[model samples]
Target: MEITFYQEVDSTNSEAKRLVDGGKAPGFAVVAKRQTAGRGRFDRVWQTPTGNLALTFAIPAPPSRPDLPTLALMTGLALHNVLQPLLGDRAQVKIKWPNDMLVNGHKVSGTLIERVGKVLYIGVGVNLVSRPENVPYETFSLAEVVNITVEELAEAVTAHWSATLAQWLETGFAPLCDDYNAHLYGRGESLRISLDRERAEWAEGTCTGVTPEGHICLADSEGHVTRYNAGDIDIIRTLQSV
Candidate 1:
């Protein structure tokens, strides 16, 4: 639980990876007040200037569950639990399967995890005070919708997030899935899913929550069920390009 805060940096994730690769201990968090080159999942550029949370940490990989995707989902569930109390009904925080935090169907935060050897680097970017308006997409900020300070939210998240992760590591993903589904947004809806870079398909389904291994469960149009292994298939945001 060694936390280091920076006024500004290129990316907390990048910096944390450097420390992890350099043989830093597990649970070392590198938090940046502002990230010049913040990144999202799939190398997407995350835009932020200041007054937002850009935090990353290193967790030493375990002998079991070497896959990074599982840990990423676990991290998302941790965030959901940590922030949900502060959010209340107005903030409307819900997790879009995999690891995207959405507020009223708009992306408010994202998580990116990278593994270097036995160390896993988890990056989390949360929109606290100000949200970008450059892209033709909807976004949200916790401070904009509520009367909470970034420092206040950060402290709460750090405390609750750590506890949630510890529980996941101690037990397993099943219990985590139960909590994740409770805050799930899209339960019964039609979705446009990108099968690959070259193909996209429209599927009408009910979100049956996630699998034991952290895959999203989609009960498709044909009464058949499928689980999406994170990073394999892209779940298109029906509203806008995010």
Candidate 2:
């Protein structure tokens, strides 16, 4: 793993993409102390402060290009896999569809992906000690919630990231869907989802996991399953925005 550490940067994803476009290999991680212009899924501004984990990894050889969404989901699963043990049952790590990490119905971390040519840059921002100011949703850090240091959590993420990426590349999204579905938030519950433009679209029943193509499956009150590709979605009961 080749990691480039920075005291601060605009966005690690952008930097890593620049490297990949210039012919960098996979397994390269770019970390920043502060992200002046961090972003989340759907191009939303992710206000992350110093000391949080802002990492973007480049994957030079993906099994398929359109499978990038599944790859991002797998990456979030890896993050959850490493942190859930430390969180135990208290924090309740639930994975939002695509790539958002929630704790106790509140968001603690988010992931984004940008693909250039065949190389992919997967960006992740986890609130480690503090939340970005005036953020719409409630956020928690691993240290604040679970009493662990940032370095320890970062080390754990780095170690699992490699393994997770390899699995995603080889086996595709089946394993990822199973693992992520097991840790899903509000698996069988009535919920309102924000489909587009933050309009609250009500859906009842349970989460039936995702298709291999990386769509969110929400079984409605009428027993009809609706799949979401990517956009704004939140678990309505807790008002937890994802």
Identify the candidate with maximal lDDT: 2
Residues 1-242, candidate 2: write the lDDT tens digits: 77788878899998887776687676688888789999976578987787888888876755545676677778778988987888887778888766688887677888888777667777888888787667777777776666665556666787798888777777788867777878877666655566666565544446677777888778866789988776556566666665
Candidate 2, residue 133: the lDDT equals 62
Candidate 1: regions farther than 4 A off: 21-23, 66-68, 197-204, 231-242
**lDDT of all predictions, in order shown?**
0.73, 0.76
How far residue 140's Cα lies from its native spot in candidate 1, in Å, is: 0.5
How many clashing residue pairs appear in each of the predictions shown? 0, 0
Model 1 C-alpha lDDT per residue in residues 1-242, reported as the tens digit of each score: 77888888999988887776677777878887799999876677997678898888778876666443567777777788777777777667778777778887777888888877777788888888888887656788877677775566667677777887787778777777777777765656544445554345434355676777877667766778877774332234453444
